[model samples]
Target: MNSATDVEIHAIKQVVATVEHAQRYELVEEFVSLFREDAIWTTAAGRLLIGRDAIAAFTWQVLPGAMKDLVPSYEVVHVLFIRPDVAAAKVRQRYFFPDGEPVTEEGGAPRCT
Candidate 1:
């Protein structure tokens, strides 16, 4: 991918930061607020959530106690500009222990992606 304009870069970064912060803190309402009313969200488990309302409903049900003792973080691996007004971002999400070690196989894998 070529260089993104400053505005585009800043906007994308803001979105990423917001999402990361929301997830790390289990801020379900804030996370849901990031999606558009007509947006579609697919769960890692293959559940399809259409519209912000459905997304919010699902999110609220599972966010709390989801992380428990672990912390979640996102790293933006790549960004592709699909259109002038639209972009697709690839992210690497990982869970870590409070001491900063990566959660391992004993943790039984990360859920609620």
Candidate 2:
């Protein structure tokens, strides 16, 4: 069996934190770096975005429209080592909408490309 190294774990944690903060701050520069050039992001809105340019545009467009109280929380379920530079974590993220309704989801994995 293989496991994630300390550096990889730290990188992943930073990515998660950046995402959590994006709900409350401008994190396009930070969050964009965590992903590969050919990254793909699928939003809960069913929108699929590809490449850094498109993703950056998407980020800029959506950040201001997100719920004011939107909060993202995640749980690390399992980590599999694909390589020293690549790893995947199985996680579930809940987006809490304080003034409206909280959205809870489980199942499905978010792959960091």
Candidate 3:
């Protein structure tokens, strides 16, 4: 609602955009760069990855050809600021085929937090 919040939202949107770009192009390094050194990532298949190094390893193994037949998209639907410097974003993820057909279940409009 304030200028600071607006700026943060804009920055978050940019991060979401970058994520979409990286996934669309399967840029392993670019995708991994979004995580902090101590970040933890849980894959959709329930694989738990701890730390940037682990994340990088997993990404390198998967991201390169992950998008060969599909396009991944991320949209930030909500952003909850727990504090001045801490925020949690909710992102809606979808996949589409190269021909623009939805690859995942149909859902409502995409959003991110």
Candidates in order have lDDT scores of 0.80, 0.66, 0.86
lDDT of 2 by residue, 28-108 (tens): 676677668898988766789998888888877766755455655665656787876668887667665565355545433
Sliding window of 10 residues with minimal summed lDDT for model 3? 104-113
- Tens digit of per-residue lDDT, candidate 1, span 2-82: 455667866787888898788789999999999999999987567899999999999999887777788877777777888
TM-score to true structure, per model: 0.84, 0.69, 0.89
RMSD of 3: 4.7
Model 3 local distance difference test score: 0.86
Q: What value of lDDT does candidate 2 attain over all alpha carbons?
A: 0.66
Superposed on all Cα atoms, model 2 deviates from the true structure by an RMSD in Å of 5.5
Sorted by TM-score, highest first, which candidate order results? 3, 1, 2
Better of 2 and 3 by TM-score: 3
> Best candidate, TM-score-wise?
3
